[model samples]
Target chain A: MSAQTATIRGWGFLAPAVLWTLAFFIVPFVVMGAMSLATLDGRTLVWGLSLDNYRELAGQAYLARAIAVSLEITLTVTLVSVLLAYPLAWIIAYRVPPRWQRLVLLLAILPFWTSYVVRSYAWLLVLARDGVVNQTLMGLGLIAEPLTLANTRFATVTGFVHFFVMLLTLTIYANLVQLSPNYRKAAMDLGANAFQTFRHVILPLTLPGIMTGAFLTFVLCIGDYITPQILGGNTELTVPQVIMVQLGRRADFPLAAALAIVLMGIVTLAYLAMARWLRLDRL
Target chain B: MPWAYALALFGFIYLPVATLVLFSFQNGSLPVPPFNGPSLRWYGDVLGDDRLVEALLNSLMVALGSSAIAVALGFSAAYALARHVLPASALWRALLIAPLTVSYLIVGLGLLIVVQRLGLGLSLWTAGIGHVVINLPIAFAIIYASMGAQQQNAERAARDLGADEARVVLLVTVPMLAPAILAAFFLSVTLSWDEFIIAFLLTRFDVTLPVEIWSMLRSGLSPRLNAIGSLVFLVSVSAVLLLELTVFRKRRR
Candidate 1:
């Protein structure tokens, strides 16, 4: 029947993607899980069922601290990104007309178009000892020499905000754009002012956007090894660095696998929870 | 009230890029100030570096190859989801989005182990394979988003007119989805080009631009590196500008 053909066609269309996911995502995860039960005897991983890697993951003080630190950083960064993004999303949605709004949206996305390495390097120059931040601060008598923004947590967080805010703003705007302005106008006609209208109607409607953006930013911030590696000094070790150290340097593949699995669990849980609360597909 | 914060944020964004642009004009080796005079030596230097050029080609090839393949797979997934209420629509949607939620680092780690065991090892093909893995889900999401907005009843109309499934899909569905497909291609290219930890961790000899740039950073700055970074930036800026302008002009018309 015609309906039967559509269904078969649907299955046919889905075959490649399903195969890709199972092969890449499902199978690799199986390998990682299998690997984490291993103990590396030099170059050879003596892989029979074992719990040593998980035990090590649980016991290490530094590993625990690094994971905690990464969680903390992810939370703060997500909050900062969303906080900054809201007003911009508001302005873009309700304030600007269509033509100008498109241009502004383009500008917001502009930074991400370039290589992230180049963008971070640009940040490095701006934050270095003789960098622009200190120069300007000194010019205004805010500080005598450079503020030591480079190779610091501040620098890492700043870089996080720089690249991430645009994505958050856009996600929020996508939701905000479809919203009819009449609700706000009706509220205003009913004696609600700008603050009340925003607080009551606008915020509630855009809650889904905020949640989606926040979820993404949180997941990305925690998993990010690059920004923290480039900017964060030794004093601010994060979870990804620990995994890198284990795998790259010590060749402790089991431990690295175990650590990454834990991170994956956290990310997967957050994603599922977000999807349950607000359909993540809309993102 | 919020104006001050907006201004501060905008300033933070622009100043670093401006400094990078200025330093590219520096005549000497260092990226720091105390410049003598403006020169295009760095730009020349960037163009001259063989390693950088190789990396550039590697990035372009991988991005184009992965984006094309991934977009095809993605368009299929999107079409399936949009056109049918399959046995488990919500579950299928969830599975499609799972990869997007997982970090690129995890995906990289996962794929590296699988492909290495299969004898593919680390090369441009491996990198392209890895890119295809991660980009497929995103391409699906974007195309599906556009699909939801489209008027799909036309396809049904075409189908009722005695057209075959392929004919309906080929004649009606694809033309409607062209813009979304192109946008997905652009997005995939951008994502592939900017992806760092994955390519850096996976590839050995065949590196992407971000990997090349990262390694160069460890040895410290050079006019050559800056020149390369600038070239990468210039290309990125043009691609983004072109994509946005096309969409904007289309919207206007």
Candidate 2:
């Protein structure tokens, strides 16, 4: 085939994907950006260059609170999931027998196959007043009554942490298994204690993995509607929830678009912060 | 100590799923504790519920349809980018993969706006479109990463033998990348099958399983919900095990 023909064939092959991305991904995103700047006049959408939605974000306490609530919940989930997952990933990667490692890892992430919405609902049931957790606690004589565990920020955090710890463990474990033993041996030979060796040698090497997992947890957790919506009990709403309310209940697409853009902005900020360490391609 | 911690974390992870499955057999109406005698009544009810069954079929259709499109597009893009010396391949790859970074809610919301503005009614097709949008990047990534010089040399040889491009792709290139393509397709199916936000946003009456389940949850608690949740969990777990025993195990070997 001539080079010209090959080029034409290449374009032919590439056109579909390129057009799909441009039409669905790029065009929708551009429209969403424009929608964010447009305002709703009563119920009808007024298309214009206005910052009313954003201005409303600052002026409205409830809306501003959603941002704070989302940020707080996301940060907490990221930190706790990382701290909890690191040790688990460490134990699995180093302590588990090689033949059993795959099984162990598989078991760790097995529940990830379940419906994401159902998993959140399961947490709701488990954390319910008459649910397994409170029943168990009372059965053990740890409490006189069931603590209000469900329908709170705590429940939301627990649900988020449950999902993310499994995720972070996988990422952190991948980082752990890739480390050459020579690094640890070299550190031990240099009179470094075990703790010092880990702190100096292993920790830095795995920071990338931890950060990558944490960033993912932040993005997914912050953007998620199901976990917070089901468990949060509408006492407070996350950004995604608020965005959904805008779209579902009010049909305020412009405001919803603005909220989505804010969400996109937060994720972009996170990506920028973790760009140095993110090995998403590795995933 | 590590064993104890590992066991504890394992229990924590499995706690909800175990509870979900257990309550699925509850004879009572509520899914709470005080497990009643083992009963398949709720399972029977779930199986008989026309809407839930319809939603299940809808979910399957969307999952399979969207994943097929995603895999086809992803494979073609990967093949072209890998085989041809295209200009600015990196830029093209980046554009294709850009959706991976964006949130699903964002993607769904974006499409929802476009669809609404175009005065198109929401349906399973719109939701499937959203699924394709999200799954495409993932499919592309997996297929693109697996495209290596082995396929390249094989395709070159096919071309040298005077095989046309289509024949070369169908016979040689596709078979060479079968594992990656299959993996991508399966992964996309699994994702689209359980995906909620996009489907919830994009679909109206002919909703997928997740949206139906969401509505079910809103209508009050029931073991029927448990039965349905358990059913989905079982199906998914079975698929995972099947993949593990076959495709993943073969790949590892």
| Top model number, lDDT | 2
lDDT of 1 by residue, B158-228 (tens): 86789887888788888887778888899899889878888887899889989989998887655566567
Q: What is the lDDT of residue A172 in candidate 2?
A: 92
Task: State, as a TM-score between 0 and 1, how close model 2 is to the true structure.
Answer: 0.98
| Per-residue lDDT of candidate 2, residues A1-283 (tens digit) | 8999998899888888888989989999999999999998888888899999999988999999999999999999999999999999999998999899989999999998879889989998999999999998999999998999988999999999999999999999999999998999999999999899999999999888898889889989999999999998899999999998998789889888999999989999989988998887777
| C-alpha lDDT values of all predictions | 0.81, 0.92
What i-RMS does each candidate reach, in Å?
2.0, 0.8
Candidate 1 residue runs with Cα over 4 Å from true position: A1-10, A94-98, A139-141, A269-277, B1-4, B80-86, B147-168, B251-253
Tens digit per residue, CA lDDT, model 1, A1-283: 5678769878999888988888878889789888888898878878879998888777988988888888888888998989888888777776777878877777766666657887777788778887667777888898776677888888888888888887888898998898897998899999999999989998888888789888878888899888888877577788888988887879887888888989988887777777755756455
Question: Candidate 2: which stretches are off by over 4 Å?
Answer: none
lDDT score, candidate 1, position A260:
90
